[model samples]
Target: MGLLVPVSVMAAPPSVGSVSISPDPAYTDTPLTATPSEDWYDEDGDPEGYVWRWQKYSTGISDWEDIADQTDNTLDSLYFIAGDQIKVICTPFDGVESGVDVEATITISNSLPTITGVTIAPDPASTASTLKATPQGWYDADGDLEGYVWRWQKYNTGILDWEDIADETDNTLDSSNFVLNDQIKVICTPFDGTDEGVPVEAVIVISVLDYSGSIDVKPGSDENPINLGSNGVIAVVIYTTDGFDATTVDVSTVKFGPSEAAPVHYAYEDVDEDGDTDLVLHFRTQEAGISAYDTSVTLTGETDSGTAFTGTDTIKIVPSKAKESVQGNEDAPGQNKEPGESATGKAIGKESAPGQNKEPGESATGKGKNK
Candidate 1:
């Protein structure tokens, strides 16, 4: 042997044989733990400890990204979702150097989401207002919330049962589709990209909105006198106030007085001198059915948006001149005449001198006073 001398052999660095992730088909609801195989070999002895590195593959960037602050052996369920690729690398560490890296990966499976609450607004739904549905307490273990699926239903009075509204799938329902006293319902279903969750529902009854407005009878006249016997049209003005708009009133639906007479004509003007536009409508006086004894008048109508409105005002029913003329003619015959005067206000039978007594037949010159 060529100079056989005693030589010391150096031990190889620690080497990791294999690493595995528990629950191979990982789910979003469960935590994932990494385990290293005991088959790790080192000529010097067992390795001191292990070093772990976690990474997630991003489909958007098409690359592997290291997860920060995830050096631990366990990854919480909050970190991953369905279809996510999780990988963990384990390396055996000796006193001097770190050995070869071994890794294990698992694909996260889909999990169902849960919808805990559903509500509709505004709380008191009205025919003049739009109703909107809102989903609350949405829970998804996978941290993926795509959107919601909405379905609308109405309780059909004709059928006496709930029926689905055709093509009313939006979260917001317009007032035009429903009327007063209609029962409306909205169902909300939450879903991820892959699966849908449990559904929740909310319901409300449609009500008619009541709006109070100021109305002026006869436009400029504060007394608002009405002649029941007149054959002309009566004018009424609906004022636009801070809380109500007169222009929104439907002309065809306007009714005035106790007779509920419809408007024959309408126009827009600033009747109250408030600089705001007002609605003026005309109804037939005879058709209004306002009596001379009536002290007040009321106007009722619906808005263009289906809101109901009512207004009342004091009125003084004035006597008609035609009736006064008839009364004057009836009194002209014999009533209110002086003594011994004819219907024409002259002395009866003959012209009598002053202080002369008249017999049964008085002469014209009073010469035959007792003849």
Candidate 2:
């Protein structure tokens, strides 16, 4: 039993019962924190602290690899991504020696991508122009590669809802597929080859293409005279020129004069004496709304293919005899006479009877009459 006098015992290293990581299910966007159980103990009852080591499982290396400069208790989200396994080792230390390592692991979950600055170009899209959808910024927290899925839709008045355009999956839409006044939209969805993000959209309205064409009012007549008081028809001719084809005009869509009068009748002919065929339309004079002060009138119509065109021609508005008689009476003093009386209150010219033809040498006003 020798030196039972001074037998000294060495203190055991500190040890912890278990370790845990907060946010058990990890995401790429959030930071992770490791915590050790308070049940840690030291044989010598010395103060206890922990040394943390972070690591990640590498599929390429088929083993766990240490993360550089990440020995702290907490690990940053930027270091890992979805489908990645992250672990932290916590070793309890009592200043003299370190205890067995306690590890906690978590697997990162899939994260969605974000889309920013989505826009449709050609700011105001037109039926004759192509439309393109663009996204200025696309981001994914998990550092995943990104792709886009595009879908185009239009507002349908018949269904009173937004309907998807058939086979319009590309980012660009052709001009032939849309029409004026049509409301169009493009949707973009971002994916990371594993998951998809919230979709972003851009909207626009189609506008008409205004063009000018040649027209002749009262075709073949040098003076396109219009009697304001007459209940008759006025003929208008639309000519086919270098780029415009009058034959393509949609007769049902033609509108003329300030009244927006529609055509009561239509025909095809070479009214302009040109070899190309032209469109001839007839509109009721009373319905044309032409005024004596209107020097020019406009005709607007669309082609069968939906192209809008406009033309203007000079007009000569003529007043009726009744209107002329009233004007003459108002302009002359003491000239108010009956329908058959002269301005002097006389019954025509004493020599010439009503409806009688004037002699070859005599003037109609009773001037140069034979004695």
Candidate 3:
């Protein structure tokens, strides 16, 4: 019966095939999922179980890694951070001639960025100011962020005389040169990954201003217009042609009265000062008779960012009349002469009349002879 002795055969472990990723091997701010393949029984028909690990590097690495220490099943659904280069492997139980292993090279790019906050800044500020701007923010753990840009616009034109004064596209505005009392506006646009991020606009809506200056013009300073009832009164035409420059003006958002003759000018020059001179002279109540009436006009400025930096000027108008305007030489020959009093003669026309009485040294016609 000793020859009848027999032995049973034991099974070998299952084999682990190649490991790789699906959809894509490289990811940029995205999660990665893996599929595994293995037989339940070993070469000898024994039961099998698997052990898995997510390896970032080979054996020489000082540390070993697993999805939740190999105890987790969410391995395929986990999110990967930027620049993560990894591999996956599976070992089958019921020991075999060789262990089963699956591996694929994975590289993850920059992930989605997070926008934390934003801001705006200006440069070269002054009594008459200009503005320029830029922005800032935050990011995510596994992801990275990129560059930025800002967009902007004008605020209101209803209150301002200067409409084209603001230029927010490049982010800039100037007010020193604009007529006073103008308002400026601005906003910011952030250039973020995937989509347009958030926006930051002006913290202060409008800039108001009050300046210091005083000037008085009497229209006729050069021997002025005179009115003596029928004779006339000597009215000095002294006056400030252009008033003192206004301060803190937002040029982009401004408006003017509807018409030149709207009756808003505060002063006039040579219209009614002299009875005869006023009657024969062209009655112009405006600047150089160009507009024919007293009026106001405006100009504006910007500092690059298009924000209202300086306050407005609110230009003041000066009122005037022919009686207060400038008069040539009234003492000349025919000036105010009774029709018969002087043949002071038509020879006494304004140019000839005044020149005839000039001292040889005061006459340009005598320049060569006098010298």
Candidate 4:
């Protein structure tokens, strides 16, 4: 009978009646003390009390943790914030026990601050990326923030990682001149001093790639071959990669005849109609050199983008030994006639006028003279 009682006692040990949280649904930053108690199966006539234990059952970890053993009745205080599960684990007088763990939720507020406006000087930040700028700006929220950071990308090729720049705390530019092709980024920083900040960064594109052009001269066989008298047209065409024109040539610098001297030349361009401007030389060569004078043409010019380019071109003017008056050929008509003989006729040929066929009765000069 004792053995049978032992078996029955083993079969029905204890069960938990109730376990309650002192305060349900915890709030953020609140502290709570949990106390757990259980009802016994042998409350009325059982000989021995049931064994009991307390455990902490959390959602993430895969093991049950014992908070209290059969010899102890310890209360645990839980301090939690937002989305934590609270469970009062207990061993009851009954062999069949139950746990009361409720899923709880709370609010979490992020007090992280944001960086606001950024201001730069000397020009629009985007106007020159490689510019030296004193970085300055404002921020949102009164929370403590340190400095800012940003990735400076050039032309979208990749990050200029080697160009790691410091966060600007105030408006003051460093002495470093920007690279010819460098761009800029304006980042606002606070004093917490870490590399990270709530950075308000603006991208600046530096645009100082200077482009320029000018004119040079080279004389073709037909170009300016005729001499320029004191005010004659020197006929100088300025040259570019594109083509040649006649405006930019300063004729005043051309020294002909004998003395090397500067000439005055003006430029006129039909650029509004077709293209850019060029210079030409117009001067009269003094009659000192009957032979064509060989020399160079010089141009003094400043580029469209402010570059100075001076170029000289070699040219030759064929000389005439003596100035001769050109007269029409008057003796060709009598070459084909015999001595002292007169012949008057019209031939049907290419040299004849239209509608005159040299018919049988037609006279050469509309007179009675015949062929």
- Going through the candidates in the order shown, the clash numbers are 0, 0, 72, 40
- What TM-score, computed on C-alpha atoms, does each candidate reach? 0.40, 0.52, 0.36, 0.24
Top of the candidates by lDDT: 2
> Runs in model 4 with CA error above 4 Å?
1-110, 124-142, 145-177, 187-198, 207-303, 306-371
Off by over 4 Å in 3: 1-3, 22-33, 38-48, 58-68, 71-81, 94-98, 114-311, 314-371
Model 1, position 148, has a per-residue lDDT of 85
C-alpha positional error of residue 112 in candidate 4 after TM-score superposition, expressed in Å: 2.1
Q: Which ten residues in a row have the lowest lDDT in candidate 4?
A: 325-334
lDDT accuracy of residue 231 in candidate 4: 25
Q: What's the CA error at residue 22 for candidate 4, in Å?
A: 20
Q: Which candidate tops TM-score?
A: 2
Pairwise TM-score winner, candidates 1 and 2: 2
Evaluate residue 127 in candidate 3 and report its C-alpha lDDT on the 0 to 100 scale.
Answer: 36
